[model samples]
Target: MASLHAFANPARFLKIARPLTGWLFWTGAALIAFGCWAGLTQTPPDYLQGDSVRILYIHVPTAWLGMGGWSGIALSSIAYLVWRHPLANVAARAIAVPGAMFAALCLMTGSIWGRPTWGTWWQWDGRLTSMLLLFFVYLGYIGLARADREQGGDGRIPALFGVAGSVLLPIIRYSVVWWNTLHQGESIGLASSTIDGSMLWPLGFTLAGFSLFFAAVVLMRMRDMLARARNEARLRRMARA
Candidate 1:
């Protein structure tokens, strides 16, 4: 709690992140490049889905992080509300846009994979519908955060939405099991993965790569927002003089 509170100071946060961001960015890049190569070139085609299953290497990881990022936002929002930490609010806001991007990517990739396997672009299955809802929730968070700078900056609006969204997350996750649907139930991490070892390592690496990328982007965005806040403060002081 103390450590989190300390980072709430924008200046203090930047001092640490400035040096750390470079390493995180480059390392994430390398991991992503290596993972993409391994996923696309090294992994053999799936026995059942063939080449299309390759999409899982990226799509699955993105979906995982989409949910993970929302969790981050929710946690940060809690901190922001309780601690009134400006940096926490910035961090939460920074995540919303990128999280939405990941959600959209997941949906598109899933659709492409489905077209090859499910014989249609989309189905109103438990997983598919829940995923769609998740994407819209991300968009809602991003849009609400950006809707009015004055109101949004107050931290009330986004904070409420963030809290509400967090509550909805479990519903999304369990929707597949709760409803009888076309979407398969927990086959991999969610349940016992029938995926072969040949494909699993590369898929695992891709998941790590996507997580690293998300961390890097979130840090970069937070850093930029802190700088903007600092510059605005400086200008305001100058104007008062």
Candidate 2:
């Protein structure tokens, strides 16, 4: 709690974020480039799925980040509501755009992948429907956050919505297991994974790259928000003087 409070100061946070952002962004970009090359060129095609398997490289990482982004929002929202941390709301706002983008990407990629595998472009399966709902939740949070800023309302409304929307995460996660869906069950897991090492290596690289990229983007957004806040404060002081 004390450590978190220390970071609540935008200046202190910026000191750490500024240096880390370039490092993270470049590292992530390099890894993503390598992963894409490896996945598309070096790795052998799946015997059954053939070239279509290459899409997995892009699809899986986006799907994971889509969920991860919302989780970040929910956690930050909790911090804002419970501790009244100003940075928490800023972090939540920063996460929203990337989160929503990845969610939409996941849906589009999934649809493209589906056309090759499922013989159709769409399915109302449990996993797909729940993920779609998650996208909607992201949209709702973004809208609410914007409204709160414009109206000068405390961010509690969006924070509460963030917390509530978390219920969809679990449903999205377990949908494959709970229902007989076109989407396959977990191919990767902590205890063991069904994916071949050849394929998994590129996938691992992509996941790492995407995760770092997400962090870099969120930090950049936070810095911009903090800068705007500082400018607003300075303008208010000038008005008073």
lDDT per model vs. reference = 0.82, 0.93
In candidate 2, which residue pairs get closer than 3 Å at backbone N, Cα or C atoms, i.e. clash?
none
Every model: Cα RMSD to truth: 1.7, 0.8
Q: Residue 27, candidate 1: how far off, in angstroms? A: 1.3
Over 1-241, each residue of candidate 2 has an lDDT whose tens digit, in order, gives 7888898887899999999999999999999999999999999888898899999999999999999999999999999999999999999999999999999999999999899888999889999999999999999999999999999998999999999999999999999999999899999888888988877789988999998999999999999999998999999999999
| Model 2 misplacement above 4 A | none
* TM-score to true structure, per model: 0.93, 0.98
lDDT of 1 at 9: 66
lDDT of 1 at 232: 88
Q: Write the residue-wise lDDT of candidate 1 on 1-241 in tens digits.
A: 7876677666687888888877877787788788888989998998889898888888888888888888989998888788787777888999988898898898899899989898999988877887788888888888888774556367767887887888667876777778887766665865557788788778777788778778888999988887787798899999999
Q: How far is candidate 1 from the true structure (C-alpha RMSD, Å)?
A: 1.7
